[model samples]
Target: MNVFVSLLRTGVPALGGWLVALAARHGLHIDGDAVAGVLTPTAVFLYYTVFRFAEEHVSPRFGWLLGYARPPEYKALPA
Candidate 1:
């Protein structure tokens, strides 16, 4: 399940690129290169944001699936 989600996250940009190319080929009057330039950053930010949200929200179940190990408890030093 986590692996599938990981693949989906990684696939969004490539899928966006393909969709952009499809639009370009259909007389959409959009520049594929420019669209890809915009999408790259957007995809990266979206990926990170979703990753963090999932890490915080669904972490207990998805944690090990994504190779994240819970950190060992630490004692605070006296101030």
Candidate 2:
């Protein structure tokens, strides 16, 4: 379920953005309740449909080209 995990990791932020846009469209201020409302199944479907394609073409790089380093919190996780 790597794909599912990846979707969840990305979907949360996209859902937030969708809620923000919905609020802005109606000239309403965004808050936690607004965000929750916007993050319905429809919003998640739209975000997943768009971002899955984008993610497919992007490659990961670590410890090269970017002077990459793992965060200390990452090391502490049980593996």
Candidate 3:
């Protein structure tokens, strides 16, 4: 399950960025690498935005997409 979720989480956004580059190549005159360079960060931002929301407001299960099926380790500083 975690593997599937991880794959989807990675594959979808990457596919989206590639698709954008494809569309831009068809319509615009810009280079594909440049378009991907711009869209990659946008895709990542959007991915985090959506999944973070799902993880918080929707269900804890969504955390699987973000690789935190449970909370992280807690470390207290020395007194």
Question: TM-score per candidate, in order?
Answer: 0.41, 0.34, 0.56
Number of clashes found in candidate 2: 0
Q: List the lowest-lDDT window of 10 residues for candidate 1.
A: 63-72
Q: Provide the RMSD of all predictions against the true structure, rounded to 1 decimal.
A: 8.2, 9.4, 5.4
lDDT of 3 at 5: 59
Sort by lDDT, best first: 3, 1, 2
Candidate 2: list runs displaced more than 4 Å.
1-7, 10-14, 17-21, 24-39, 58-79
Better of 1 and 3 by lDDT: 3
What candidate 1 gets wrong by more than 4 Å, as runs, is 1-29, 60-79
Give the number of the best model, judged by TM-score.
3
lDDT of 2 at 49: 50
lDDT score for candidate 3 against the true structure = 0.66
Local lDDT at 20 for model 3 = 53
| lDDT of each residue in 1-79, candidate 1, tens digit only | 5555556545554455455455544664577667666765665565445554676787754333333433223457899
Model 3, position 11, has a per-residue lDDT of: 66
Question: What lDDT does the true structure give each of the candidates?
Answer: 0.53, 0.47, 0.66
Writing each residue's lDDT as its tens digit, candidate 2 over 5-36 gives: 44455556465557645755466556756555
